[model samples]
Target: VQDNLEGALTEADIEPLNMPEMDRDELVEGESFKFTLLCQVKPDIELKGLDALTVNRELVEVGDTEINAEIEGLREQNAELEPVEDRGSETGDIVTFDFVGTLDGEEEPFDGGSGTEHPLELGSGQFIEGFEDQLIGVKEGDERVVDVTFPEDYQAEHLAAKLAHFACTVKSVRCKALADVDDEFAVDLGHDDLSALRASVYDRLFEAATKEKDGDVREQLLKGLMEANEIEIPAALIEMAQKQLQNQMGMHLAMNGMPRDQIAQAMESETEGVLERAKEMAHRDLLLDAAAVEGDISVSDDELEERIGEIAVDMNQPKAKVRASLQENDRIHSVRGEMLHEKTLRWLEEQASSVSGDSTSASAEGNPTADDASDSNVEVADEES
Candidate 1:
């Protein structure tokens, strides 16, 4: 006979429970046993006041100042450095030099104390604050001794707030020539003219701002929904979420060029913070899933395929290749879950009331762009175990 105290539970489902030990010798071969299994189930999440939730959508306006800033950035990107023979070192000029630094009255130089043919930008503040200023009037071949004090919070503990002297030699100076913001620059960047480039930039910025605003509104709605709902999350789910977070963090570090040893070291210091964040994320995801079920929201195979196609296009890969890779990595479910979350958020947005603010500009901090929203939806899809 099968155990029915917990209502037709299998071994896999019954693992996370307090079950009493059973002696196999007490039963014969092919014989069954009956026992009680005490277990906890997923809590019921009642999402209320969703329709009454009010969120503010900040409308960000692209102005002339932002447009000009973009133009300036483009100009900087197109700038060229030309050697300057007539003038001494000055702000905005690149200076090349050699130097040996030592602490006061010390015969031995400090660690990382000497370098040759080092090219530095005068006003870039790459060196200590006073070190660059002392080189302002120095000519080529001029030998000078620069004095400066490291900041109290300097990275090197031994050098913190320490006075140091550098015996320096001026080598060469180069000034940057920025390309003019005109038709030629526009043509070089594949645009028709200056006006055309400006218009394109404005359109792109406006689109980004709009997407960012939508993301902010969605976040506010999610926060409101969570506040209106009360539920208890399972400990097993939290542990699973924490493990997923650790894996994601490791992957992120590896992708960003962090070595295995360094990643391990960094993770050691970040475990507590990561676990807390995992709990919060897990709680939010549980609430979202419950809300989706209540609203009869679901992801279809066609919808999942469409999203996969979009991903392939975005990544510039073949559709079949992308699908194969996702399948190999077992991330197809993640894509489906992300789509479902997106649909749920859209539904929530429609059901709730929103007010557009009168402000013409706003920062996009803590906001989600269309791309961010998509990532957020997929982030927890495969993590839920």
Candidate 2:
């Protein structure tokens, strides 16, 4: 069988040829024709010594100082916005005020600039340039006018390159963050206490650091493997990718109630860009899969579940919803393919040579167990229950 397969593969051109011997009788059921397919394998690149593929490992050392800094960041993350008492508007202070603007000192061309108690953060660049700058040092019950110019390339065609003056009134000011990052803060975050918050923060930071470092190693290995391998990818794959992009984009626009003509016009321009990207991505996939198959690397179901769960967490969506969407869209298959690529890259990294920095090496003390790549391919539940 191996010899026959090899012989069949050798006869193929740059593109893969169908293998009639591998055809399944099931494919002949109903009105469909039956034929076996032998996907022409792209030229495989030989990966050498597990140690010869030069790579850099950030040899991260996670000590108490780093942990503390991470914890402090968490505290800032949990910081609260509170109304200020007896505070005036200053740079960086969020202000609620009423204002009107005029084009050439006249209100006729500047409608909609008038509002009561509008919220603006000083120095936030939320308003016209220099508008916020004028708000600095203004207290409640104060009023001032500021001169500014709209940029030549402003989005609003009518106002582009127009000079305008804002007639301003300061109503109230809210000060900087006053949230207490103590036990109360933890409770606010729905945790038991500050210690629990710290523990959670630590776990999150450790996971983030590990992921970043591992991803770096994997990317470097893939870059090397891609450079080493020669592969032939079908032009049809790029066309398919472009069509898929158009369909997805169209679906998104339709969901938002965009018009047909608008979508068609947009697709005409975007299709070219998408095609180029798809070609590059297809080439990368071909090489990665070939390298992975040679190395016997693959992803397990458990890893997919974990990754899906992580995506859900990041998107603030329910795991069940995400799982359903992935399954319905055939995205689960795509996810598996992505996971396979990641696994192959990691395997290459393991066999490759590496260097480390002092900061990375210093943080090597007592980090938790690495997310084991071997434990992948097993089914992982979205919830413990």
Candidate maximizing TM-score: 1
lDDT of model 1, residue 210: 80
Q: Tell me the spans in candidate 2 whose CA falls farther than 4 Å from its real position.
A: 1-52, 61-87, 98-117, 125-129, 141-147, 150-169, 177-199, 230-233, 239-279, 298-328, 357-385
Instruction: Give the clash count for model 2.
Output: 16
Alpha-carbon shift of residue 86 in model 1 (angstroms): 2.7
Question: All candidates' lDDT scores?
Answer: 0.76, 0.67
Per lDDT, the best of the predicted structures is 1
What is the RMSD, in Å, between candidate 2 and the native fold over all Cα?
A: 11.4
Summarize candidate 2's per-residue lDDT along 1-385 as a digit string, tens digits: 4555566556754345233336545544466544445454345555433345777777655554565566556554544445655655677677788877888856563755578889887887888787888788877778888889999866455678989877778777766563445566568888776666555655676667777887787667766765665456666565666677778888987787756776676667677787877877776777777768778887788898999999899999999999999999889988889888877776676567666652234344443332321121112223210
Worst 10 residues of 1 by lDDT: 376-385
How many Å off is the CA of 290 in candidate 1? 1.6
